[model samples]
Target: MADLNSLLDDLAAESAELEALVAPLPPEQWARPTPAAGWTIAHQIGHLTWTDEVATLAATDARTGSTDFTELLTEAAPRIATFVDDAAALAAGAPVPELLQRWQDGRAVLAEALRAVPADAKVAWFGPPMRPGSMATARLMETWAHGQDVADALGIRREPTDRLRAVAHIGVRTRDFAYAVRELPPPADEFRVELTAPSGAQWSWGPADAAQRISGSALDFCLLVTQRRHPDDLALQATGKQAMEWLTIAQAFAGPPGTGREAGVFS
Candidate 1:
């Protein structure tokens, strides 16, 4: 696992890259619809801004030993399924400049709060408690995933970067949660995941001798797990039945099962 400080730096860089992409867009372009149905570029950024605020609360609670975050989780439990979209829709109404600034400011505060968390403490989250490193990784994964929506809306192809390593790591770690959300049994054995990183370095997880395995470019794997692209459009290969099944339902983010992108949409 990466130390919290290094992960935080990467998170900042990833957020900056996405911010630059949207910062120069004219106000009218903010309404361009992304791959996510009914969600425009403004909605994408709005979602990120709202989530960062929630994350800030979690991090603040962890740092100060408070129950503010727990109270939020309790309050939202009944509406968890719709709360994410509801918040995004609400934030989407703000002027584009204001939405952009809120995301920028909220994430900065989240990063600072995360840094102050005690080394051994786990922060309360919608799904589970997370240490600062895990929280940062989750934030990075969401930022990159939402950024994909923004990029696709603008018809821009972003070059794959090493930052995707964080996204991929989350995808791998969330394998079980993906199954759990669907009320399906998780695979009994670990699967080896091997990918060729953009920098030409090899990244692998799980046992080298694991029976089930997935291998491909890190970029495709990230896109697949984030539900940004359908598996049929990617070159990822699965060696076992369960591994293949996982590809069909894999989701890196915490939520209900995502409908996922349509196959061949990007082809």
Candidate 2:
């Protein structure tokens, strides 16, 4: 596992990259529909900012228990929804330059709060208590996934990067997120994953001796688990019925099942 400080640095770098990608967008594009149904670029950014604030609360010992964490997400969802609605309303009449500045400001707040967390601390998250390192990893996953939405809306492409490893790690660790959404317990046995990393290297997860195997490119796996890309779009090869079953419902993000968007919409 990577050290917490290193993970924080990685998240910081990705956050900066995300800001750079969206900071200069013209106002008219804020209302452009992203691959996510009914969400525009503004909505995506709002959701990202809201999630960062929630992460900040988690890292600060603010969550009294799991109930508090759950409530936080529940409450924030509507607020973020409203934020998107309001932003889209403004986009109808507001100048593009002003909307872009607002995006920059919101992202700045999120970046500052993320940097404030202590690297060695443990914090409440959607699932198990996570160290700062894992929390930052989660943040990076969100940034990359949501940034993909923004990129797709703008019809732009971002080069694959080793940074995607953070997303893949979350996808594997949160296998239970998939199960939870289906109202099922996590599977009993571990599954092995062999994927090609962005740097043209191989990566593996789970027990080496496991009977089930899921192999593919790291980008495809990350996108698959995040529900940003479909398994069929990549060179995914699954062996063992259990591994294939898992792939049919994999989800890395915390939420109910998504609306099952088209595979590789971003690709």
Candidate 3:
């Protein structure tokens, strides 16, 4: 379920975009808090840099990753402090330029590792094993999602790009993952998902005639899945019971079910 090449390209583009934004800012801005509550802009990029290094290790190393990712799902809502959070906090004190360079270097190494692996070979991760392609896609999703927080915090409105197609693809593919993370039995019936891309092209997944359907702008759908924007702020529509339920709790990034932004919380 991964398009490795496109995912990798998008990953580079996204990292570059975020770096460009943070590079010119005054030092104090790096310490400013993003919408993610206590996390500052530096903290978001710090997490990205740490994650890139871990993902590279999993893709190239014989052993999979170090932790049981799903082990934390039970502790989802309140989100107790874990190793990942601690690492990000520690990295937060590094100078902004150093953080940006670290992220750039780590992601380049990850790109090389991903390309060397067999396309269908599974790479070990915290929750489940993913093919190199899927692993790269997951990395792209995390990068873009975190970038959104940085953008919002800096008060910059990024114009949606074709790169979103990769992100939207993951959001659709992770439908079952989202439900599974919450310990709910995924619905037996499949749902149709359709989204209008930035270039005005339509993209979709699932059966065309499924009783359940969700359709809207690709950007809005992406925002919903990444937990960046509450569903109420998007132009999305759901036709059946399952579709409606998924909209309320859907997430593409792994771990526990995220406590999404409250309605009307973000303008």
Per-candidate TM-scores read 0.98, 0.81, 0.91
Instruction: Give per-residue CA lDDT, model 1, range 93-187, as digits (tens).
Output: 99998998899999899989999989899988877788889999999999999999998888899988898899999999999999999999999
Model 1 residue runs over 4 Å out of place are none
RMSD of each: 1.0, 3.9, 3.5
lDDT of 2 by residue, 135-197 (tens): 778878888898888877777778888888888988898887788879988879888998899
Runs of candidate 3 exceeding 4 Å displacement:
1-3, 62-81
lDDT ranking of the models:
1, 3, 2
> Which candidate, 1 or 3, would have the higher lDDT against the true structure?
1
Q: What's model 1's TM-score?
A: 0.98
Candidate-wise lDDT, in order: 0.92, 0.73, 0.83
Model 3: per-residue Cα lDDT over 1-267, one tens digit each: 436787788778888888888888888999989988789999998999988877777776523443443343344435544666776897888987788789888989989988887766777766577888788788877888898999999888988887888788889888888989899999887789999999999998999989999999999999999999999888899999899999998998877788878888776
